[model samples]
Target: MKSNRVALAALLGLIALPLVVREPYFQHLMIMVLLWVTIGTGWNLLAGYTGQVSFGAAAFFGVGAYTAGLLSFHLGVSAWWGLALGGVVAVLVGFPFGWIAFPLRGAYFALGSLALGEVMRQLATIWESFTQGMMGVLIMPTFLSKLPYYYIALALAAGSVLVVRLVLGSRLGYYFISIREDQDAAMSIGINTTKYKMISLSLHAFLTGTAGALYMNYMGFIDPHVVFSLHDISIMAILVGIVGGVGTVYGPAVGAFIMVALQEVFRSAGFGALEALSKAIGGGFMAGLTKYVSQAHVLAFGILVVVVIMVLPNGLVGDWRKVSRLFKRAS
Candidate 1:
């Protein structure tokens, strides 16, 4: 509990730093980081908490983006209302997805989610009349500014983290951890595995979808490729969770920071340096190194996921607990 407070304090400090520094570019990066973190927290609730490995977050994200985008474009609705409606639409979709997929366990459930996402992406492509198809929808000039977006994204991220913290500290959270450990056992002990799972997933989809609405408005554009990209869902959801330490409150944030920082570094290196670095590293070095870093940000994210899973099976916060126990023993 004390540790959690400390971690929260650190997060507050990072957010507050921008207020004093006042760099637009850095603020933009910070906005991206917070958005990913918020989405990751939502994913963590579903996969990390409920033990329902859903890879279809991109689908829900796309749904939210489109819902919000269409509403804003056609009805002249404000983003504030669009954000809420996006979440509502996502939950409506999530209920059906969860209802069908929850029957399948483990890999089967994951496969079902991946398929659902693909189907949604195709639909987004085909629905040219409403979605504007591959051309995308753009957010025109509005009363909002970058500072408003920065704070809004921060609030979303903070709200996600807070909800995760609240859940983990409650009885419902215990039910989730039990289900994750052993669904059958959780059921035998009188916990309704299905009920808990659905609740977790619904909350997960809602938060992540809301973040997507914010993302579209922030970018001032939305396209099928960008909104429904499989890569976007995987890196921001799974990879972030894996690297930061899954099922742990602060893990996703740490993973987001590391993954984003690495991307910025490699991106700043430029294409020529990237090619030279690739060649200098050779096949074996490249093969091993690629596990830790990749073109843009995805590969680096993949590597971090692998290393964390291999080295710290329980995740960063979980491992920290072990280390803390060791120190106590030594004392």
Candidate 2:
């Protein structure tokens, strides 16, 4: 009950944030947080709950993005339609891939996912006539204001959380958890492990693809390199799942918020706070620090990942009790 109240309060605060804060930059950050929430939730659903670790989220993301972009470029349809179709297309890709890859387990499955993403990237690059290759794709955005996109992103994030909650509360959720625990046992119990695994993969691909379509519509431009980036998309999704709390319902939400904030802090050189400090201190070492901070975001991410793994292997939310105990010991 206490946790529920806290979550409600946080949601209310976020819903009211735009009314109180008008900075486009801040709004952009929040948008990113929501986007990651969507991606992370989908990743957690498959990898965390179903025990099928995937490193090919970018493939689904890129396919959805390209679906949306191509619709606008070739079909003269609104890119918004891609929001609905993108997930379908991703499921199409995931279905066949899941059929082939689900037979493999553990690290082998992970490697298969990696290969899938690389294949998609190469395909996007080679098919210059169809995909426009490195030239990229662009479309006119529907709204002039950021508010629409913000609300839509919020809806996507919230809806994902709700869906996860509902699904986990259902019978299928138990099957997924069982499979994650031991697929052989699940199969012995007549769970049809393969079917459930495919279902999880399809759901994951759909959610990720939907996010990609949203990205295309909001950002107005995309290239193969940008959309299909393994490190930026696939690895980040894994990080979000691990950092948040792999099997927890709201873990990805908290993880996304933290990760996005960390990203922005580095990307913006502490939101230019370092520059202000440099100016105040006469710009010697602080200025040099500011110059390098933007370039060091990836380094910061790596250090955080190591720290999180060492200190809280189950993740921030999954190991909340342990974390609190540590804090108490320190105090």
Candidate number with greatest TM-score? 2
lDDT of 1: 0.80
- Across residues 106-154, which tens digit of lDDT does each residue of candidate 1 receive? 9998898888788888888888988888889897635354788888888
Name the lDDT value of residue 300 in candidate 2: 87
Q: Indicate the residue-level lDDT of 276 in model 1.
A: 67
**What are the runs in model 1 whose C-alpha is more than 4 Å off?**
141-144, 270-296, 321-331
Which pairs of residues collide in model 1? 291-303, 293-300, 294-300
Model 2 alpha-carbon miss at residue 295, Å: 1.3
TM-score for model 2?
0.95
TM-score of each: 0.86, 0.95
lDDT of 2 by residue, 90-139 (tens): 99999989999999999999999999999999999999999999999989
